[model samples]
Target: MHKKVKVKPNSKQQKIEEQPDGSLTVHLKSPPVDGKANEELIKLLSDKFDVPKSYIRIKSGLSSRQKLVEIDKEG
Candidate 1:
């Protein structure tokens, strides 16, 4: 599955909120430096979807707040 995620880095806590439009708002504790926030995002999504970390990939927006993530459930 592919998800549109809006990432808020350097948050006090980590959390994920599902939007009505089938997107996600993710608050991450890690700062957006050296791909830390992206790593955190993949970890969070992995737990939420009951998948391994390797099953998640950031399809786009590597250097932006808005990202497109792909979750390979069959993996």
Candidate 2:
């Protein structure tokens, strides 16, 4: 599955919120440095979808707030 997500790094709490527009808002306690936020995002998504962290890939926006996430269906 592919999801459109808006990420907020350096947040006090880590959370995922489904937006009315069908996108997702992700808050991560990790800072947007050294790929820490991305790693945290993958971990969170993996937990939420019951998949392995390696099964989640950031398809786009690697350095931006808005990101496209791809989850391996076979996982």
The candidate scoring highest on TM-score is 1
Over 4 Å off, model 1: none
What's the lDDT for residue 21 in model 2? 88
The lowest-lDDT stretch of 10 consecutive residues in candidate 1 is: 34-43
Model 2, span 1-75: residue lDDT tens: 899999999999999999998899999999999999999999999999899898999999999999999999696
- The lDDT of model 2 is 0.95
List ranges where model 2 is wrong by over 4 Å: none
Poorest stretch of ten by lDDT in candidate 2: 66-75
Model 1 TM-score on a 0 to 1 scale = 0.98
lDDT of each: 0.96, 0.95
Q: For candidate 1, give the lDDT.
A: 0.96
